[model samples]
Target: MNGVSKVSPGVGTGLSKPVAAALSIVDCDFHPFVPLQEVIARMPARARRSVQVSSYAAVLGREHNRFLIPTGEPLRLDAVPTRGGLAGSDPAFAVADYLDRWGIAAAVMMPIQAMGVIAWAAEEVVNSYLAAMNDLFLEMWHAEDPRFKMLISVSPHDPDAAVREIERLADKPGVVGFQIPMGEIGLGSSAMFKVYAAAAHFGLPLVLHPNSVDCSLQNSPSCAGRVTRSYAEHHVLLSQPGQGAATQLVMSGALERFPTMRVVLAEFGFSWVGPMMWRMDTAWQRGGGADGLLPRPPSEYLLNQLRFTTQPYDEPGNPRDLVPILDSMQAHRTLVFSSDYPHWDTDRPDVVLRRLPVELRERVAKQTAMETFGTRLGL
Candidate 1:
């Protein structure tokens, strides 16, 4: 599956032939980036050395911030071919290779390193690094193929800078949206509101992703005695952003203020959304909420405004039971399929789709993503 193949042109394993043929599947989440040394080489002089030092320290397990340490052996720059080296990592595996292999038409490439830069760097440093990284991505990846597009990275730590960057890149050929973390700087804060306004103004979806926020858990109670908590953090981090950010968006009336704004809670599994929505709704009814605290049911706000990605999905004993849980929680259209490509927990599309029931599989695999990205099939 190294290159394109022409299959029968329908969703192969799920749904009736007619319905499958009608669906135009687009993988809404993908990632693409150069090797770390190459990225460091491109950074400004002021930050380049520090960034490189951090990278080395990370690989050696010498960095104080556990989040900064590499989870595996660092990629040797010498091992990556100088002329063409796109196939080794997860982004290439998902966006480029998987599309050709799985019969997907296109994939929106999100940022991985940008999330780290935003999470750890100072506001000014993060903004500058983000601009450079976005340009690097546009030139290196997005411009290479129309089938691959991008979600521009933004540092919400500096709302004004983020707004300017959004305006600057909004109309660029392959840029589709903005990327921000799920729980950074408090989702309800005024700074984030500005970022949301900019996205709404440009008709771009805000992709709320997970990064170091989960990495912080290494020092928490659950992992205190353990030498490493990366795996646990990775799984649990998915729900935290959705839980905390959704509460902020509803309670602070950010959704009320920006009716047209859309949010994609990336990497976070959809299983928790139903329960969170129910809990918020129940609390609202009991006068322990944000509406009278602000003016609507938190779930209503979510139903109208939010979309979530399904990856690292729940394995509640019986795999067949997942779809019904999603439906019971009213999370059908709200769920979009994501591979979390290149990471340890990457789910195979074929496997995940096979696990889902027919109708539910169709919605998660294709329909919901099309509706969320506002792109038509065969476009």
Candidate 2:
């Protein structure tokens, strides 16, 4: 495979030509992922086989025959082109191409496959695979560009290993923080304390990404559900588990325990902020909840420790409404812009900005992301 070169602008490389040559933007959510097989290959031999067996079992156990066949595939391993095959299917989705085309200064890349799914396997298997995947991402993608940073994926099923992994990778260049799925292993469970503690100690954020666990829903009988239903369930489940976890962390004294830990609710959307904050505040003001459980209202803890990413935004809603909503939620500094690139429903800054006033656009696009990630525009 040929070494991939950064696609330069104005060379007609199939990217949308930038409207402003001087515009500097940083995309908080971009995904430039490696193949699963590549991640598998990087593991130790025993760990590699274990992952394969688990993956095979999961696929074969499924009722669908889709797992058995060798679907037609390609062997090329370079960054899949921004133009033909699976790569070019969406003209606007290429990360490198989009960065250059849109005049983005940098982007923080997240993994495509949710690492939490691997936690369904045995603990050792999941931990080893998670470590391998993180190491591979650090060595392969993030190392290639100083501007491209990554969120290290962690499996909370084994909190000890999760802590060790965080300690090992905390200082590694290009690793900005850790990514945890919303409903994986119940955030309120005692099992996750060590992981949260480790993140706090390292001064790295724990990003709660949106995903569905088999046992997350309260009364859902079987994990088997239609794909569309599951997708919808995943989105709705996001804030519920996150809120539950945040509440637990406060009530259980995780925040009192750590004091400096930060959490980011990525891609859970921002509409719920208003109501969630109101309810928490109301409960606290009335002294309706346990007094010794937390130092203040749950919303107060979240304001200090939590942040959220905005994507799949509702453009039809009044933009001015977001300002006060965030302020009331104490999330003004917590809201960051995200593109959710490569997904079907992604936000286009150029088009989204045209709808908003110039001041709002600058805050959401650049200032918010910079504050959240603790980095400045490379440009």
TM-scores for the candidates: 0.80, 0.77
Model 2 pairs in collision: none
Model 1, range 276-296, lDDT digits (tens) per residue?
888888878888433575477
Considering summed lDDT, which 10 consecutive residues are worst modelled in model 2? Answer: 58-67
Those runs of model 1 whose alpha carbons end farther than 4 Å from true positions after fitting are 1-24, 35-44, 47-52, 56-96, 119-121, 182-184, 216-230, 288-290, 376-378
**Per-prediction count of colliding residue pairs?**
4, 0
- For residues 1-379, what per-residue lDDT tens digits would candidate 2 score against the true structure? 4777666643235545687335567677776555567667876788777653333331111212121222232112222464443431222335345666676766777764544343354677677777877887777666666566778777656678778888889888777778864444666566887887788777777776543333232123223342224344644444555566556665566766666777767676666776876776677677645445666777667677777667756554566765556566554466666776645456766775554445566766677666655642334
- Residue 217 lDDT, candidate 2, scale 0-100: 21
Best by lDDT: 1
lDDT of 1 at 374: 66
Score each candidate by Cα lDDT. Answer: 0.64, 0.60
Q: Which sections of candidate 2 miss by over 4 Å? A: 1-15, 20-23, 53-95, 114-119, 214-239, 249-252, 288-291, 317-327, 354-357, 375-379
